[model samples]
Target chain A: MEGLSQGEVIYIIVLGSLGMFLFIAGFAVFISMYQKRMLQEQEKRRIIELDYQQQMIQSQIDSQETERKRIAADLHDSIGSLLWAAKLNIAYLGRLSNFNGEMKDSYLETMKILDQSIDSVKRISWELTPEAFHNTGLSSSIMELCSRLNGKGQVIVFKEKGNQLFWKDDRALMAFRIVQELLNNAVKHAKANSILVNLNWNSNRLLIEVQDDGIGFTLNDKIRNGVGWWNIMHRSKMIDAAIEVKQNHQQGSAIELTVPLSS
Target chain B: MNKLKVYIADDHTFVRKGMIRLLNTFDRIGEVKEAANGNELIALVKKTIPDLVVLDLEMPEKNGFDTSKHLIDHYPEVGILILTMHTEEVFILNLIELGVHGFLNKSAEPEEVERALYAVADNDFYRNEIVNHALRSGVRRSTEASSAKLSPRELEILLLICKELTPHEVSTRLQISEKTFFNHRSNILGKIGARGNVGLVKYAYQNHLLELSA
Candidate 1:
């Protein structure tokens, strides 16, 4: 290894330094490309969440439309048929006025029962409407719904906090809807003994609570097939409200929703 | 015979028609009118006086509360029975104040409907499960509002007493004298404005503090 000229040595060292610099710059470009890919992935996830919300809403609309049809069918098939039979039977009973007092009373009672059953089935259909708020206020409508639910299995109790209530048509409609959706969910699934609904209005916010004493969801798991819950959250979002649900310290679960009043 | 004349208001034609059939079965039931909406119910009610008005909460036009309020204001003699599926506590409390005498679930048995109609038609006051629940909630709420007034020791003693603890037992448990326990009990009664021990228990029950031991 003979010594090289000083200029040649300087040129070699400079070229080596340039090569090292190029390697680092190439690595940095690859890292930047990787970061861009990750950002695209994140954006894709956000779009998917939004799409899920839309789909959930569409499915709810579809289900409600379908429910109206099925309820109509139930009335026509089950209750309607029963009433027609009872009406025809009443005519038959009228022909025999000479029957004993006990038999007459029994027939009359049966007819009354059948008639009322027919009414029950039909009224169920009428209750499931978004227009109830415009007709009554949201507060009254919720109470009426809760009382009606008392017939099923569980006892539903409603309570309001404070003397005043704050709701515009849109917020009232949202509150009504969320409450209805929660009750529907309970009826369909929550095999509970009782449900408690609390509607509170403070100066700053309107809070709605739907709770039940039943088999609650696990801490780790999302509520299974909770389309209505998602719809409620989406509506809450639309109004810039916050929503939270948790398995209460008691046996059941509670849903807490807060909608800002002035904000 | 009271000869109670009732008006059944529901949007669905079948419900109104069906209830009419049931009411007609009773010999005392006279002048049964059918209404498909709140507007029709209120209008007809104005024309022909009804002894008992059965209103639906969910209607396309005015709802049961609105119609009932109008009827109550115009004619206090007319007893209003709200018929609907909703049982939220706030709704019950709100309507109860509006002179609604009875609340019946749509799914109630025919016998129950008959009983409710008759009871409200003639009652000191109609208190059903839904209304009772709402009232209990109300009482508890008021107690919570007044919680600030009670001293910490008094609140603790009241909570213990609400657990159905005997005065002697409380004295032993709290390591206080029997006279001291009695004094604390009296103080609780005074603060709650209860007449006596039984009244205090009722207060505790209504406030939902009675079942704390459970």
Candidate 2:
């Protein structure tokens, strides 16, 4: 080392420094590249898990809907028919002569009771699966729902703007269910007095705004983790819709849903 | 004043039997025949046309809607009445447009059924509260822009029907025979491209033809 020339020594030092610098830079790049690959793998797995969850939820909803439809049909077709037959037979008996006043009164009372039961059956079947939802599209079905829900102190008003668009049955059903859920929550939980459901049709999307005057919800953990909230979120996700929850200024809550119609 | 022959069709044998028994009690209804479904009803109608054909909407083989359409196209003179558990306004409106004579809820009292039968038999159409409310509130499906316009008489008939007046009452008030009134009604339905009473009411409401009393 003492016999080495100064130029050679400086050159050796510079070469060593250059090699060290390159090694550090290479190490940094390799570490970063490895992290990038790990992140990509993690993201892929997350997406797969999300898709599997979505599929599971979808099938569950489908089966539930099918069950609801079947039950509604059974109630309407079987029980309702039997009740009608019984009512007719009772009516025929009433038409026959030689009944005492007491017997006549009892017959009338029985007929009245039968009538009430028939009404209850009709109401139950309708609630399970609205026949209007299948016959008419979402708009009229919602209108009918609003009318049905309007009379008992709580007033629900449905308004539409712009031209109505035709939606696929499944998608329309989801949207209807979401709206129904919102309305139910408003009536049952929020105890809203007056609710307004406005549907705005845009070129590529339908915007639904449900505003109510009731006890508004706080974004607390209870509400955030609620089953109703969970259902609304998952349903909106299934339809590829965007939902916004807004706490109203004075009272009540407002939910806005934007449903894309392109699909 | 001949006995009004009726044909009743239902999938449930008990319901059909009960209905027939109740109908038998009515002085107006006679020679009541029964069918298990819409197809059987159609075959029965082919054998001998009845004054009125009572239909249950949901049935095996052929449904009420198709059967009604066939009857409307083939036997225009036969009065069709729908008696089903389905009391939805949409169903009522659709059946009316298909030219059904009347619509009755399955839960309706025997007396109401008798009245509906007599109404259909007498006036060719029944205007119950259900039909009226449905017509007044329902939104019409946007049909093609019809260039055909309603004449003065047809417009008058449309307004009267929208006012909840029955066909018999409207004809009597207008000093026309029931046949002439029905012809005008069919013509009005055709001119406006309306389905039936529903279309007429919707058109009347949309065009501000009827004065809605609060």
Candidate 3:
């Protein structure tokens, strides 16, 4: 050591300092990379959690729909048959003509009431889950709905202008449900005298417009009234569709949904 | 008055009771036998062949499909009238293929039931408007499938059945023995893949043997 020159010592010190600087820089890069990996893992976990939540929501909705369908079928098959049989029995008695004047009058009146009851049962079951919707597809189901509403003194008009559109069963069901909700809101809240529905399909997309000429709710009112809005928004998101509800006191309420199609 | 014996096959007891009461009121209806399910009805029917059988499709033990098949295969003489709650066109069409004498909704008036009973007893097909509409639509949907060709004799028998002629009437009209007429009807039913006379009519409709416009 004593024999080493001063210049050699200076060179050794410089080399050592350079090595130390390089090690520190490498260590910093390693730490940064590790932190970045952890952030990515956390992001992935959050996405998976959101996906699980969406699946849960979808299953809940599916189970509810299944229950509604089962109940509707039960009502139609069991109670509906019984009512029909009762109606027939009464009709038979009325034919016998053995009843006196007052008795015959009561019998006729009973027949009328039974008829109404049967119709009511049919309507309730249909509203729960329409078998017609499944059998005939969306357009005819909607037409049937409008006709029933019209029969009951509500003027609901349906218009379709374009090529006939076909949709998968589940998608059609969801769309039908959305329309039903909108019409219900119009009937219950807007107190609308008339409702207009338009369904149009073009080359790449389908558009649905439902406009009511009744008391309308503004954007603020919609935000405040959260009962059915949440359902509509959730369903819209589920189908990868967009919905816009516009309303004002003077202009009435209007809702439009735009859906993209693969075909 | 032709006193006709009728058998009722339904899962619901109330429906059975109501039908029995209505049948009792009809002067032409003699005995109204009640069975809870198709199996019970089959057993009772084997013992005593009723002039007509009223069946509901969704019965327990044996459904309307199997029951109708059994009846047609064993006792083809008994007329079958289906009274069901289902408004499905497919179900009605399938039953027609089973060769039911008539198809009526459970909601039909007692008068309709009486009419159907008399119609079947008279060896004629009895279908209300609902059944007709359903079958007409079925024909339109299934016009693509062709049926086996019928001989002139078989075609004559089919037309007579469509006219609601009984086997005896058909035999008398053609001056053939009842047994021979039965053999012809069976052969035709097999050739056309029909379960009974109702299926024969449906076949006639599908092959344009019967005019849809008419």
Fnat: each model in turn: 0.00, 0.78, 0.28
Give stretches of model 3 more than 4 Å off: A1-27, A88-97, A132-136, A155-168, A186-263, B143-214
Best by TM-score: 2
**Inter-residue clash pairs, candidate 3:** none
Clashing pairs in 2: B97-B195
Residue-wise C-alpha lDDT for candidate 3, range B149-185, written one tens digit per residue: 8899989988888777777888999999999988998
Report the error of model 3 at residue A215, Å.
Answer: 4.6
TM-score of each: 0.45, 0.80, 0.77
Please identify model 2 stretches exceeding 4 Å from their true place.
A1-35, A97-105, A159-169, A198-207, A211-226, A248-252, A258-263, B137-146, B149-214
- Model 1 lDDT per residue over A16-96, tens place: 999999999999999999999999999999999988977787577557656866776555444654464454346345443
Candidate 1 chain A weakest ten by summed lDDT: A87-96
**Compared with the true structure, what per-residue lDDT tens digits does model 2 show for residues A135-157?**
67888777777887787779998
Q: What local lDDT score does residue A190 receive in model 2, on the 0 to 100 scale?
A: 77
Q: What is the lDDT of residue A84 in candidate 1?
A: 41
Worst 10 residues of 3 chain A by lDDT: A218-227
Q: Which scores higher on TM-score, 1 or 3?
A: 3
How many residue pairs clash (N, CA or C atoms closer than 3 angstroms) in each of the candidate models, in the order given? 15, 1, 0
lDDT of 2 by residue, B140-179 (tens): 6545344667888888888887665777799899999989
- lDDT, candidate 1, equals 0.69
Interface RMSD of structure candidate 3 (Å): 2.7
